[model samples]
Target: MQTNEIDVRVREILRLALKTDVPEEGSYAREDDPNWDSLKHVEMIFMLEDEFDVQFAEDDFAKMGSVAAIVALVEANHAA
Candidate 1:
């Protein structure tokens, strides 16, 4: 898939998982959004895994705190 396609899907997943619309041009982090609590974070992980058809390592879970990070991880996994 193309980068823009991955970005759009990631943003949609974040919006649905957090139940909030994400900005198109800004960094979003769990620390800055109340909607991105532990439960929601886990949910988002599952959603992303399913959406991207990639399994995440337990340690890699920690790296998914931000939209940029999540997109990067997903892209990396997809490439792998």
Candidate 2:
């Protein structure tokens, strides 16, 4: 899938998992969003994995600091 396609799905998954509408600019992060707490972050990861059908490494969990990061991760995994 294209990065834009993955971005759309990732945003939807984030919307469901994070329970809020993510910004269109894709600059939001856990440190900046009050709704992006630890539990929601985990839920968002799981949702991303399920939506993209890829399991993330434990180290990758900490790297998901922003929507763009998640899109990049999924795009990389999808390419492989």
Candidate 3:
């Protein structure tokens, strides 16, 4: 709907699935972020769908990197 709404939902998803509330924009990378791993990434993707009622394709899932990227994905697919 709105940017703030999207950000809030994304932050909630990260907090719950990744176990962290810190996303400093260009400061997080998949290989370096503490909460980022293969298994947790999958969990976060599933939770994003469940929590936000959005469906992500498998390829879309791979394209997601940082928390910012996930937020962008959710916003991009929000209406679909």
Model 1 has an lDDT value of 0.89
Task: Please write out the lDDT profile of model 1 over residues 3-30, one tens digit for every residue.
Answer: 7788888889999999997977578788
Candidate that beats the other on TM-score, 1 or 2, i.e. the better one: 1
Ranking by TM-score: 1, 2, 3
Off by over 4 Å in 2: none
Candidate that scores best on lDDT: 1
Superposition error at 48 for model 3 (Å): 0.3
Q: Give the lDDT ranking, best first.
A: 1, 2, 3
User: Which residue pairs does candidate 3 place in steric collision?
Assistant: none
Off by over 4 Å in 3: 23-32
Instruction: Give the per-residue lDDT of model 2 (tens digit) for 27-74.
Output: 777777788888999999988888889999899999998888998898
User: Candidate 1 or 3, higher TM-score?
Assistant: 1
What is candidate 1's TM-score against the reference? Answer: 0.91
lDDT of each: 0.89, 0.85, 0.75
- TM-scores of the candidates are 0.91, 0.89, 0.77
Query: Which candidate's TM-score is highest?
Result: 1
Expressed as tens digits, the lDDT of each residue in 1-80 for candidate 3 is 78667666776676677787555343454766677788888998898889778899889988888666777888888756
Q: Which pairs of residues clash in candidate 2, taking residues 3 or more apart in a chain or in different chains? A: none
